[model samples]
Target: MSGERVAVVGVGQTEHRAVRTDVSMVGLIREAAKRALADADMTWTDIDAVVIGKAPDMFEGVVMPELFLADALGAAGKPMLRVHTAGSVGGSTAIVAAGLVQSGVHERVLTVAFEKQSESDAMWALTVPTPFQAPLVAGAGGYFAPIIRAYMQRADAPDDIGMMVAVKDRLNAIRNPYAHLKLPDIDMKTVEESPMLWEPLRYLETCPSSDGACAMVLASERVADAAAKPPAWVQGTAWRSEPTLFARRDQVNPQAGRDCAADVYQQAGITNPRADFDCAEVYVPFSWYEPMWLENLGFAEPGDGWKLTQSGATAFDGDIPWNPSGGVLSSNPIGASGMLRFAEAANQVRGAAGEHQVEGARRALGHAYGGGSQFFAMWVVGADKP
Candidate 1:
């Protein structure tokens, strides 16, 4: 079915860091919102609705924080919605905001996602005991280590692929001023020597707990025509979710993620994602996820995704650049992580991604996932209006 066209008119993000004590949660979100508004050349009154997202409230030790942020986000009398989809909440929130415009419910929508990990321990929060769950799993690293090992064994991948991703992404992070882990001197040797935190996963390979926010202003076709800057027109959006764990679930290359990607690509008329998209911003909190997601997203055949990484095809200057913004590994604000990926894709299509920009980029992809690889969200954006 045809829907009203939507375009991303503005994108903004906070400088991600281990702790953002200078601002309250409201202040942090407001900072990104204000920047997005400024970029859109609009005011609070111009926003018809607001949608916010983040990781679990326990991660920040706040319950229903959006209720307190309504006024700060200029949603005093307007409709405001909240989304929670684990790590994919950021991307899912943006999708909902786009739907507001696509469905003609709103002319303009403001979407924001953030996480203040300093307020609470995310590792502990995730490790909280639950009924019928194994107690042996430590943190995120421990839980995913076995999966990484399984991928390695199945694909016959070398042990150094993860380290290669770590070095490449960390080097790319140096170009992103907002990235949390800017290891300027990071190299393959450095990654190789880093202490192994969970078997196959090293300390340097894991994402950092960060406090940051991301905001975007989406507008309908009529409003987009008046945008001050080029808009990243939404070509397609799709989301999918599956039971976190089941007898037949495949965490390494989740069927839900593949379905989500296929749906979006079909809607966008993309027969070949690696050829159609100029670049991509994918959720890669763990370095190995780059290859894993490549396969799941149809960028490569099963078990062959690592070959692209090995050949540097995913580099910023490669044929199909991936994570030019350094990805979640460089800066992970939990709830905002997925939105950051979506926003970065928009920035690239708009030619606003400065140092990390893909030259002459016209189309890009944004992808995110959560909940033991069950939830998935993705979108295709382009420079021209769809």
Candidate 2:
């Protein structure tokens, strides 16, 4: 169905961590779904449809997990769809679920995304050998290291930029109780001294292999009107994809990502994102991505993005804060990270983010990308109904 308008009524996330061995995949998603339902002051019976998404089957050694998790998520006998767009699955999942409501087909829907990376090695899972591809790459780090290096060279960014992103996000995690990597003492010095995982990508720059899930409940205008708290109105949402390998794709700043952001901002009537967006929850698995995306998102010039990070513009109290929820840096469950961004944005608009809440925040942005930067998804949500 074509989604014209939608609103997020509830958002929920399990305590993100490296290992959620206490629950299986189905159990993990159900836990989050249950919390979302409760947050809306509704029951599973109230949900009209369900959508589940994750990065890859290899990560959890569970192919077609949603088929097995249907009943567990109370999705039995209902329309259930699964989305796979690499790391962007979570945000894409939410968009699809919201479509069900905006199309006037369903009143309320439940959407979830998860990754139990502990069941298998995520690094190895992502290092699959495609035909004619070189075998020297280790994992995501290996693929992204050269790009980060290029960013450093192209932007003339200082080495401290990475450390700054790491420290700022980690400290922001302190305010977010559900963050996975609770590095209570994370600091720029510690990050600079941390072991180097991949060249130009320090150990602290990499996101942890986490086992976690995130869930959200989308409702129609009528349903949202009855919600327990003010709902985050779905102001604008967009998704874009290009082939995995394309000539002049601009890996550092893909056109798809730029186009996706433009689409969302257009729909939200935002002329300048850096000023219009009160806060943003973007998927930054690596610290350098913060600056790279800043430029891509039009927050700064092509080569001056690092200046914002260095000048503390991206900090919580800064003019245009980004990722006050600690972001993917503090808690990255690959499959769930994108949804976490979208959910965190909703939380900020709803005033649900306790310590990380941007006071009087009226609007926020949630963003994610995946598949060699070919897939992109973004949404703009506002405190007032749009």
Candidate 3:
């Protein structure tokens, strides 16, 4: 590998909500793309390629919708690609776009991801009948409840830890104007008292099924050098996959996630994530995964991550604050969730995150994982050019 450098010149996202019926899928994407182009001081004509990603077609009842969205996205003649990898599609899409630049294929690329769950029920979409598969799980909450309980058992993490995460992220979301679920009055007591959707998962703990889209404009080193302001240089990026439903799979702390983080850290020369990365945006649809992933992502040793969370190490004012943009816990459009994480990290570096911006965020980590803990994607972005 010649180690060609890449950087994010533009980033944009739609305000996540329960339903964005006012605009079609194409409109949602265009809105974000236009914002990104404006930020890059460019336009649709300047984009050299386009890449779109989303979760399964079942969620929107539109199989490979990107095929029909070409004209609207202004990619009629430009190179285009679509990617599907469950919930991590967004982050994975960004990685693919960055690869185009790093591989010397394209100087500019537009990557976008979206999900309009309002068109269909995600619970029903995910529970589609499969031969020999049990029909007990209703949706993601059901599928993940037992796993969360196991974490609480194995790690002996206090129940309040999950509640605290929900409250903190919800509070953080208020500052994020684009967040989907904005609980202004949320607090520890409110989270503790919220109705239980699934055992070990409360209404406050589960991610909201939202309708939104996110987009990013990536450029090569030469293109980045011409940007108006400092670009978020793509220091390192990685993606990994493992078979789902494996007998040996540890849902609580998947090795694929650990390996994925290790790869990006190694490429970026990061030996201590807790100390090196100024801030992070991790995919935590459920609050408990905050601590669980803290351990899995090498930020803390197993059985010790909860201590950090309890100590407020992951809070907004802590040593290495995480999810300063509120994260997937605050706003999740399923398909776009992962990409938003990457975009947010890029936003922090670009000094464009508005109220949720981390102070002097020089180095940041954007991370996402999905599909029964089988897929992982992460990237390290820095203010300084790579």
Candidate 4:
């Protein structure tokens, strides 16, 4: 069935860091929620529903933490839903909230995603053995290392492409006050010389385990029209998933990601993503994924994604800027990482992003993937109503 139009009225996020020891989990969420409520010029009483997401319970060592967080999130007497879709949970959570408004079910919805990595060892939590699969990899880095190596070989990408991305995103983080890493001196030599964690993936190239939260308030078109600030109109949203591992599954470029991008672009009437989108905020937990996702998202042709990076086409001043807010590499709180991308896209369209704002960005893309790159979530947001 066709759905009602939805818009993002407010967005907020915590100051991402290695450890947010000042606040408890409840306090952390409340901080973001309060900020979002204030941005929307509303209060808890205006929210009709709440949706929350995170990577995994094991990462925080707290099973069903949402139960205790209900009161803090203002969901005690309101409809509350929990979501867990690995790394893509944040993006998926926002999608669910948008659906509530689109389906004429909720006039206003508060959606949030967070992770307190200091509470538990994310490496250990991610490496937990599963039945029928040998526990050979140490963490996400180890598992995705081979895939990156394969991409380099298949695409004939230069060895320095990853280093370029690492430098670019970290430098961009300098303009983002809320990002975790602020490497003002980061450069090619620094990235190339850093210790190697996984083959071809250096310490600078990997994402940090961070503690942070992000929240957004979505509203129906009727409510959004009366909001205090400009609303980011939801042009299109799509999600796709596939088994983690199957015969001949192209880990370098997952089919699910391709299909998800295709669906969103089709819905948005985007014939050329590279030209149609002013900028993009994609989930790039690792440096290399920038180019890999560039291809998967149809921004570049196959085996040519790295060329765009090498040519500086993805930089802040480039034709199609990417990750102007520093991105996953700079402040990855796992579950919150994807929502940060979505939120950043909305910020751009609303002209709220301060130093990192793209000039005349009328439309933008937000993308996320999880679980061996099998789960995909994408959306297009614009300043004009759809």
Candidate 5:
């Protein structure tokens, strides 16, 4: 939708798990970067620039991580740019890297995002006191529970909707080799019986703490045309942000998310999101957010998002499959989760998603959100050029 066409020619991700004991932080990232380079059939020298991102320093107790990770990613001599936009950093990082090619500033760009939750207590880090703000006593779940309750009250959605999503995504994870959680016996009964962490959010419905990394190689149309594998053509990309707290702010369906989706959809020429995209990989850390985001992203009308999920429209074989890769619920490596969604969307369009591949997928949507649902990023990719 701009100066030059950008396409994702390569994608790679480390095996996600609760704790990646096999590799140190540096090793974890290198593993992903190496895989991405190999997938692209290119060496570090082939890359013109590097872009990387991760969650807050407190999560890893490492300040300015890019500085130490530069050599590990072969970004020492290249123009490496680090991005931070809370949990949306990964998606924002990819968008920025793509921008380098889209603006004709670079022919090839390598982007990576990662997180090692085991390095430090992510929950503790998140609950830390912030000036003029109520503490997140129960971490993310505590903060979002009220918002979710508000959605339930406003939509009058079935209590079983969240349970259905948990079962669906965990079952989907069974097909994803790299996903951290592989609960093959995950069913609604199992989900309902699980311990309730936050009201309406069972242990099964909440995302796990994970350590993982993801990487992608983005190139200009010329470079992508010469690639060995089919590329996922970038149709459009957009991001938006808003203040976390304000008078009567709509946390259930933030305006920033709506605006971001509208912009990307317009650029991608999507008149009806539900019918246009074959699949979607969205940021749904909690099962309830799936339905909430469905409305915010315009995939469903207000107060009707849960109806689609309840009708099985978001299942793996549904009319519009959402998070076929198991998504954040199964393997949430906070920083990497956003890029994982973006990468999975690309994989679907390239027909390289293996078992999770959406048949005949020509177009797909990738979405991510962060910071009380204030920051939003989304992109559309396709098998055909825009």
Candidate 6:
């Protein structure tokens, strides 16, 4: 919805792992940035601006991180901005970087997002103490368990639906070299036998605390036209948010997510998301979130998402593949997870995804959500310019 066309000319990510003790926070970011610049066939000096994003400061024990990271990101003399919106920061950051080019403010912008969960007690930091409210004693899993239960009841879904997702994504991770959890032997029995963490969510179904970073180089159409590699054109982008504890808030299917998806689809001329896009990379830190997001993203009717998954509609070989790169369930770097989804979608359209590539993919969708499912960011990218 803009003045100039925007395109993603390069994307890169670090090898995700539970703990990256070898690299400092700055080093983690630089590793990804360097790779992105190389993918773009450019150096740090080619960037006109820089944008970075991360989770709350308490998670890293670092405040105003952008200031300290300015030189590391090649932003010391160039315009640099930091973005934060809970887990959606990565997707939001890329949208902002694209805006700089779309609005004619910059010809090329480099955007990066990262998290080093091993360096800080993320569970403790996420357990914010609110007045008059009981403490979140069990972290993210406990907070979202009730919502998953509600969806199960509302949909009358099979008990094995979550297990199926766990198996599929883990298998997908085996194909992704950079994914953290490469559970090649993962299966339905393995997932069923795993210890339950949040009543319905088993240990095998949850995302690991990872240390990694993801970076992308966005440029104007003029620059993309001359790039060495094929560019993924940005057809549309949108973001939306609402109060976390508002009255009558539908946690199972937040209104902000629905609205945000609609806006992005409208901008991309998507009348039927399920049939329009070749694939999707959605934010699914939990296994069950895949089906939940399928409904919210307009890929399935309400209460029918689980059935779609059960029918193998979302499998890597299926018609509408989701998370061909294994997704957050396999490699979650918190703040960087969102941008990872965006980058993977871009890679799919560019025919750059090696093993998990969708055959003949021409258009794709990338999505992310945060803040108790109240904040949502989505975009559509294509091989051909819009």
Per-residue lDDT tens digits for candidate 2, residues 262-373, read 8889888888889898999999999999999999998998998899999999999899898999998888889889999999999899988889999999899999998677
lDDT of 6 at 151: 92
lDDT (tens digit, per residue) of candidate 6 on 1-386: 66699999999999999999899999999999999999999899999999999888787889978799899999878999999999998899999999999889999999999998998888998787979976766688888889999999998899899999999889988889899999888889999999999979999989999999999999999899999999999999999999888678999999999999999999999999989999999999998998899999989999999988999999999889999999999998999999999999999999999899999999999998887898888889999889
For model 2, what is the alpha-carbon lDDT of residue 276?
90
- Residue pairs in collision within model 6: none
| Candidate 2 Cα lDDT to native | 0.88
Best by lDDT: 5
- Residue-pair clashes per prediction, in order, are 0, 0, 1, 0, 0, 0
lDDT string for model 1 (194-270, tens) is 99899898889989999999999999999999888999999999999999778999988888999999899988989
Colliding pairs, model 1: none
Error of 5 at 125 (Å): 0.4
TM-score of 6: 0.98
lDDT of 3 by residue, 1-386 (tens): 23578999998889888999888887888888888888888888899999999999989899899999988888989999999988788889999999889988999999989998888888898888899876637887788889989999999888888888898788888899999888999988889899988988889988989999998999998999999967999988988999877788898888899889889999888999999998899999999889999999889999878888889888888988879888888899999999999999998888888898888889999998888778998999999866
What are the lDDT figures for the candidates, one per model? 0.92, 0.88, 0.88, 0.93, 0.94, 0.92
For model 3, the superposed segments whose C-alpha errors exceed 4 Å read 134-136
Once fitted onto the true fold, the runs of candidate 4 whose alpha carbons sit more than 4 angstroms away are: none
All candidates: TM-score = 0.98, 0.97, 0.98, 0.99, 0.99, 0.98
Which pairs clash in model 3? 91-339
lDDT of 4 by residue, 214-283 (tens): 9999999999999989999999999999988779799999999999999999988889999999999999
